[model samples]
Structures are given as structure tokens and as C-alpha cells.
Target: MDAASVPAPASPGPATAPPGDLAIWFFILAELLAFGVFFAAYAFARAHNVALFDTMQQTLDRQAGALNTVLLISGSACVARAVEAVGRARSATGARWLLAGIACGAGFLVVKGVEYAAKFEAGINLSTNTFYMFYLSLTFFHFMHVILGMVILVALWVKTRQGAYGPADMNGIESGAAYWHMVDLVWIVLFPLVYVMR
Candidate 1:
């Protein structure tokens, strides 16, 4: 064949970038740093009041904390599935997964709310001691993140149901999923530190 008639070898596709927007990753890093500082404060406080922390830890609703753990972890898994589905252009399936993830996050909030109610009923407050202070502040901080994460998931679900996300346009859903995973991760660490640690 004439060289001019032969096709050139196919060029490889462009390299894949990270799943989400660069801005979202930077936001995630900042959020993680804030959580890290909070965690370190908890650890430092606990070290100086080991006996008090241990005693107070015993009074916590271990079952409730454990349940919230399950709920958050399940939520994270559902979000992951949602992202995967969206990447495959299966918007309906992605919406379903996002809804499931939202439900899981809501369950966590409900369980944690009940736990807080009980604590307040028993007159527990930040003034209760160093332990309750850290427990309430740390967990509540995480609680707000969960709420924000759920909000992001809800938005993603709405857009996904409208066929907004797909392989060609994944930045929004991926960014929201990244933040939701961060919320789940902080809870995983908080549960052990504030609920079960000695």
C-alpha cells in the first residue's frame, strides 16, 4: 500500500484526571484539616482527663453510636454506587442509589438526635465536664457535616434524576460524592474516639 494511503496509528486518549473539580479537592483538604485539628484537641483533652473521659465514655449509648456507624458506612457505600452508576450513564440507577444514601444519612441524624435528647434529659451539657464538652462539641460538629453532606446528596439526586450526570459530565456528582465520603470518614473516627475509647 502507498504510505499516504495507510492510516496513522491511533493516538491514545487523553489521560484521565481526578474525578472531581480541583476546587472541590481543595475544599475537602481544608475540611479534613479542620477535622484533624478538632480530633487532636479531643485527644489532648482526653489525655489530661483520662479517668473522667473513661467514666463518661461508659455512660454513652454504645449501641446508638454503633448504629450510627453502620448507617454512615452504608450511606458512603450507597454514594459510591451512585457515583459509579452515574459514570456509566445510568442516571435512574444513580438517582436510586443517591436516595438510599440520603436515607442512610437521615437515619444517622435521627439516631444521634435521640441520643442527644436523652443526654439533655439527664441534664448533660458542656458544663458537665471536659468529657461531655468534647463529646458534645465534637459529635455536633460532625452532625453539621452530615447535614451538609446530605444536602449535597439531595442535590446530586435531583440532577441525576434529570439526567444531568454521565461519563461526559461527572464533575458535580463526583465532587458531592467526595464531600459525602469525607463526612462518613469523620464519623468513623469520631465514633471510636468519643464513644468507645478508653
Candidate 2:
């Protein structure tokens, strides 16, 4: 066949990331740095005004914070199970795990919302004082991360339904799970600093 007369083979579809191999590390790193800065600020403020900070801590509901910490830690466990399910090529089971993790994360947020409402009603606005400012800023920023983690779980769940994850490749799921763990880790530090630092 003449070169000009021969048909060009169809171009391949856009390259896709292998399941669980998405470039998510950079995102996780950036998020960690941002939270780190917030943590540093919190530490500095607490160090400067130890008495006031302790007084502020006394006003918070440590029980609720501790319960939320448990929820997040449990959610991390579910994500681990989901990653295992993906490695076993059980996409449906993986989806179930991811969904359960997402539900736990949601529960954490709901509890946080209740805490916020209670604080708000008690006139614990950010403008109340430096300690309240740090408390609101740190917890609210953490809340935003929780929302992001939920979104990631939903995406992973959809990808699982689409059969994108399997035994051969579970990087996407693993990366998402790692990110969730980072969220949990941040809260672990935050809980002690904000609720138990007296």
C-alpha cells in the first residue's frame, strides 16, 4: 500500500494512571506542610500564653474530641481493609470497606459540627480570644481535611465500581488510604495539644 494511501492506526486513548499509582504523594506532602505550619503556630501561641491556653482548653469538650479521634482511627482501619480487598481483586468488598471508612469519617464531622454549634452558642467565637482563635482555626482546618478525605473515599469507591482497582494494581486505593491516615495522624497530635495539654 502507498504510504499516503494507508490509513493511520487509531491513536491510543489518553494514558491513565495504574490503579493505586496516581501521583498523590505531592498532594499529601503539601497538605502535611500546611498542617505543620498551623501546628507550629498553635504551639507558639500555647507556649506564649500557657495559662490562658490551659484555661481555653478547659472550656473544650475533651470527651467529644477523644471520641472523634477514635472514629478517625477506626476509619483508617477500614481503609486498610479496603486496600487489602483491592489487593485480593475483590472490588465489591473494597468498595464496602471504603464506604464504611467514609461513613466513619462523616460521623467524625457530624460530631465536630455538634461541638462547634455548642461552642458557638456558648459565645466561643474565634474573636473571643487568642486561645479560642487557635482552637477554632486548628479544628476548622482539620475539619476541612476531613471533608477532603471523604471526597477521596467517594472517588475511590467509584473507581472500584468501575473495576479500576484489582490485585494487579491497587496503588490508587493505597494512596487514598495513606492520605486518610495522614488526616488521622494530624488529629492525633491535635487532640493532645488542644484537649489534654494542661
Tens digits of lDDT, candidate 2, 11-120: 86754443344567677778889989998998898899999998878989989999999999999999999999889888899899989999999999999999999999
What TM-score does model 1 achieve against the real structure? Answer: 0.91
For candidate 2, the lDDT comes to: 0.89
**Clash pairs of candidate 2?**
20-171, 20-172, 21-172
Of the candidates shown, which would achieve the greatest lDDT relative to the real structure?
1
| Per-candidate clash tally | 0, 3
lDDT of all the models against the reference?
0.92, 0.89
lDDT of 1 by residue, 1-198 (tens): 655897765886764456799898889899999999999999998899899889889999999999999999999999999999988989999999999999999999999999999999999999999989988988998999999999899999999999999988888999999999999888888888888879
